[model samples]
Target: MKPVIRLATAFSILATGCAFGAEQHVVCPARLEPDAVQPNRPPSGWQLHMLRPVYLTEGGMLHGPPAESAFLVPDGGTSRKVGKQSGETQHWSFDVPHGYTKWMYCGYGGGGATLKLFRQVAEGATECTLSSQSADGVIKEVVEFVCK
Candidate 1:
């Protein structure tokens, strides 16, 4: 079946519950536009990148070791760097796809500081929020961008 159909089916199943007498689980893999993919980056075409990697502890991430660099991608597919320590602010340009209504996020605890997001405008460009802190610190800001 086409990916969109498959995704819809999965959600339908999840929302209404199994049709049969037994419990069923539907897993739908994300579909990507092959031509839009870039090497060393994640697949695109997803409308929502939910619970996307935001922070990791000193051990790297929730699942493994320290990253060469820490970052999170929200707003459909725009990447924002999660710095190595708490309270660090890096400027991010809102290159998010149009039509997304709001961006939401929260950080992991490690640097004894909370992760914060900020917005600003510079030279007519929309400057999105930055992920603060942790060179050796690990955090994952659970972020979401919802469409209007």
Candidate 2:
């Protein structure tokens, strides 16, 4: 009888575990737009990173900077540079861990800038674009994320 009782308990526990695993999780957004004022955050189990080949636009011309400094600033966390310089563009790699409220992009050596925030909504990686403008010694940084 004791052995039977033990087996029953084990089965019950297994059933409960399965039920928990089957529960539906929150879905991520399809795409996120750029927001100069506010930061953006991703859903659980999703990772955030700055995509490579950062581009710069000036006077209606688009080009990559020889050496630019970019950072990933998380809310209430230390900021980190994207990556080392490589050729024309920066190496560009920084991951924002899940569950940190929100994050924003900050870049140096720009006149003025704007920011665009995007939230990822899929399992795979999303390619986002950040555009900034220089004005009045103010640098605005913008980031956009496109969901796959």
TM-score of each: 0.22, 0.19
Worst 10 residues of 2 by lDDT: 1-10
Candidate 1's TM-score reads 0.22
- What are the RMSD figures for all models against the true structure? 17.1, 21.6
Q: After superposing candidate 2, which stretches have Cα over 4 Å from the reference?
A: 1-118, 137-148
lDDT of 1 at 33: 30
The weakest ten consecutive residues by lDDT in model 1 span 58-67
RMSD of 2: 21.6
Q: How many backbone clashes are present in model 1?
A: 16
Q: TM-score for candidate 2, please give it.
A: 0.19
Could you give candidate 2's per-residue lDDT for residues 49-131 as a string of tens digits? Answer: 43432222211111122123223322121223333311111111234255322222322223442222212222222222223
Clashes of each: 16, 20
Which structure among the candidates has the greatest TM-score?
1
